[model samples]
Target: MKIQEKDGTIVDVFAIYWLENETLFLGLPKNYGGLISYKEKNVHVIDSTLNGEFNYFSTHINGIYHWALIKEALLDDIIERDEVAYNRFVEILKAEGRIDPDFY
Candidate 1:
């Protein structure tokens, strides 16, 4: 269930705090809080200070989660690691009649 981040480090899919099925902000995980490492030279080195620096997503204007979606890179990792959840998401998209089969 490990996937590489945009920064090139691998992380477990479940290690992220995804807010699935919640009435608000459903499916987005807490984003990094200024602790993201850019251009990591050593992939083997794990940062001990990463845990307490996560920040939950928010918006200046409140709105329903009709557009709560993960980035395509994360989606690719989830699809590779978790079939059940990926299938459920596809089903939901199908139900909405908005899924582009080719894109998914």
Candidate 2:
């Protein structure tokens, strides 16, 4: 998946994580390296494209740390601690149907 910032910057999205409270988190790497959210419609799905039979979703980036609205915690420490585990967790979410397959 691709995330297009308001400044027209596009970045690759590694995975999507869904919290127990229904908060959606995107596994992406920014300068600080953490997750992003789609609350408030600031971030939203724009389009889906096919590449070699693989479908990927494109989302527009408008807000930065919307996840903070749901919980007060630092994810950078957890994310930076073990990237492999983080990525694997995302894969689990996808496999468990927490992440929409259309965004693959």
Candidate 3:
């Protein structure tokens, strides 16, 4: 689904597997194809840190870590999670008041 951020930046959303113990979401948005540092930072690009990282994007929430945005490359991770239905992600967004119900 497409989510329009408060700043008018709408991006496609998908669900990916959660990385390790790090908190998720409400952080700066960054792009990465594989693992990278989970420490919070402000940057944009596909990170390639091998020791500790995973593909993730901030949920744009009001916290350091709370949510993440899924991308096309992480489809396998989403599927691997064995979600009951794809819309589960959408539901979570709606429940969290992140996206309007009609947006999806």
Q: Local distance difference test, per candidate?
A: 0.33, 0.41, 0.34
Note the clash tally of each candidate. 0, 0, 6
Clashing pairs in 2: none
* Deviation of model 1 at 42, angstroms: 24
What local lDDT does model 3 show for residue 56? 41
Best by the lDDT measure:
2
1-104: candidate 1 lDDT, tens digit per residue: 22344576453222232233222211211222111222222233243222212233345423222221232223333434465545554555556553345424
In model 3, the runs with Cα more than 4 Å from the true position are 1-9, 12-85
Candidate 1 ranges beyond 4 A from true positions: 1-80, 100-104
lDDT of 1 at 94: 57
Q: Tens-digit lDDT track for model 2 on 7-76? A: 6655444334434444343534344334554332345444333111222233342223323212323344
TM-score of 2: 0.32
Error of 3 at 96 (Å): 0.5
Over 4 Å off, model 2: 17-25, 44-104
Give each prediction's root-mean-square deviation over alpha carbons. Answer: 13.9, 11.4, 12.4
Q: Considering summed lDDT, which 10 consecutive residues are worst modelled in model 1?
A: 28-37
lDDT of 3 by residue, 19-90 (tens): 453332222122222212223232222422221123444443222222333432323343344343335544
TM-score each candidate: 0.25, 0.32, 0.28
